[model samples]
Target chain A: GESVGLHLPTLSVQEGDNSIINCAYSNSASDYFIWYKQESGKGPQFIIDIRSNMDKRQGQRVTVLLNKTVKHLSLQIAATQPGDSAVYFCAERGAGAQKLVFGQGTRLTINP
Target chain B: NAGVTQTPKFRILKIGQSMTLQCAQDMNHNYMYWYRQDPGMGLKLIYYSVGAGITDKGEVPNGYNVSRSTTEDFPLRLELAAPSQTSVYFCASSRGQPISYEQYFGPGTRLTVT
Candidate 1:
């Protein structure tokens, strides 16, 4: 995932609402993508991931959708709660390479 | 397991001072990575190692050096500190390579260069 500068820095969502955060990547060579969540002053934690061949993948309460045609990636948090509040980042990895390219990051604030 | 751990949560360095950031992983991961995160910016890869004794540079590797002498340790070196080098540094490791595997990260080390 890529950010020209800093576009979506913050996102506010109600406790029970489903939140959608968007990300765009510049490198088309990226074949695998993943989402990460980082709490204040903490390290980024893996959320979900999807391969280029597939368009969508889901996990516990999160879903990741990849649009290779548009070079877009998005993460959907179902029933966002205060516990889910954190900075969400999208990452991309090239085929057969372990290094990942990270997105700027969007701070997801779950309002109670 | 402590997953991944980094030493010196914070540090302040002078323009020409040099220091090393230490990273250790307990999962015995074959792949390890070092990244720097600037305020309001994405994490930029500095260097990575697939296994012990192998190392390579990533997107923004300028002025940064790394050594992976052990399977569990990856250290980042800065010879001459610069204001531009101030940022939060992270170390991560994973059992999978190239394709995919959940990467576990350390708390991070915040650095300040005056």
Candidate 2:
């Protein structure tokens, strides 16, 4: 079975500071990776995604870096805001897998 | 498009009870899925359907059953609810294969079984 894991369970950062959440996947064949932001009492929202062919991808104020060599993925948030306070999760899908496997998730707290 | 909608936003079931969670999508997507989220745990796939009349079990399909009689609806059935089945359930749909396509999720249905 494939397992996705996050390095940090919780991260606290001051507003306007950069926040990085790390994730590691066990399957090397996993090619598709996605970052999701789940706010309190809501379903997870898609942040961004990267394919194995690409090492990096960026969204409005977020960036996802994929390091297939080390089976690692990271999401970077710029100028974190109070609205960004939520649980972030990284999910991976193997080449021919039917569904994605999600990590435990990292709780991000933004300090005012 | 009302991308994905789930009925019974909140439900409380007693032990040995049976109930169904309803999910409907207007996007006319071919892929639909059901997942459960537990406290401090990631979302676990319960069931998925590639198209109408084609349903399959996912990672955590033990206590659940699903049917995709129509392309727009996929309902999950719990035969005998248990405390372990208490969790938030989400319904999602994608335009294409899940491996390469993005899935849109609904608000979710919070279920509590005692």
Candidate 3:
């Protein structure tokens, strides 16, 4: 009965501002967590990932923070742009698991 | 590299129809996976394969079957399509074992079952 879920179903942010998308996972055994971005009419693309051992990981203009104690994960995008509009999903995989469990996803819209 | 590729970008099928969803990867990855994305929802695992000739059922594998004959191909077959089977199907691949979590996804095939 493992489940990964997001805090919000939809989020709107100013184009030049920062955006944060949160996720809460139920499986404490999950050791790996990933953030994926899905643009319209396309498959989900890998954004960033963090392991339970690490608290945060950064890439380009994005950052992923993992709070294992609270079973929460977050993806932060700096200087959000129009191109950042998409559905963002968080997925988790337990140790030695062959597949990942994905959350329902958050629709992130960048406002001008 | 072409990465992961799936055939039939879009399809419409009648209930009880059968079809095969083709997936191929040129990256020479040992791990392949099939996932279905429902509207306003996330992706659900249908099946997965680790290397050629090795297949396993995933979280949602009730109406689907998969075969991994070669490292490059892993096809998912639908025996009797139903309305609930309509969704966007994505194929993904990654290096198996120690480095298996960072997956590369395909463009996806949208199927509508009426």
lDDT of each: 0.87, 0.92, 0.94
Two-chain DockQ for each candidate model = 0.83, 0.79, 0.85
Residue A74 of candidate 3: its Cα lDDT?
A: 97
Candidate 2 lDDT, tens digit per residue, A21-86?
A: 999999999989999999999888999999899999999999999998899999999999999999
The numbered model that scores best in DockQ is: 3
TM-scores, all candidates, are 0.92, 0.97, 0.98
> What is candidate 1's lDDT per residue for B46-83, written digit by digit as tens?
99898999999888899899999999999999989999
DockQ of 2: 0.79
lDDT of 1 by residue, A5-66 (tens): 22588999989999999988877887888889999899999888898999999999899988
Candidate closer to the true structure by DockQ (higher is better), 1 or 3: 3
Query: Candidate 2's error at B95, in angstroms?
Result: 1.3
Chain B only, TM-score of each candidate:
0.96, 0.96, 0.97
Tens-digit lDDT track for model 2 on B4-25? Answer: 9998999999999999999999
Best by TM-score: 3
Candidate 2 CAPRI classification by DockQ:
medium
lDDT score of residue A48 within candidate 2: 97
Residues A1-112 of candidate 3: C-alpha lDDT, one tens digit per residue: 7899999999999999999999999999999999999999999999998888999999999999999999999999999999999999999998888888999999999889
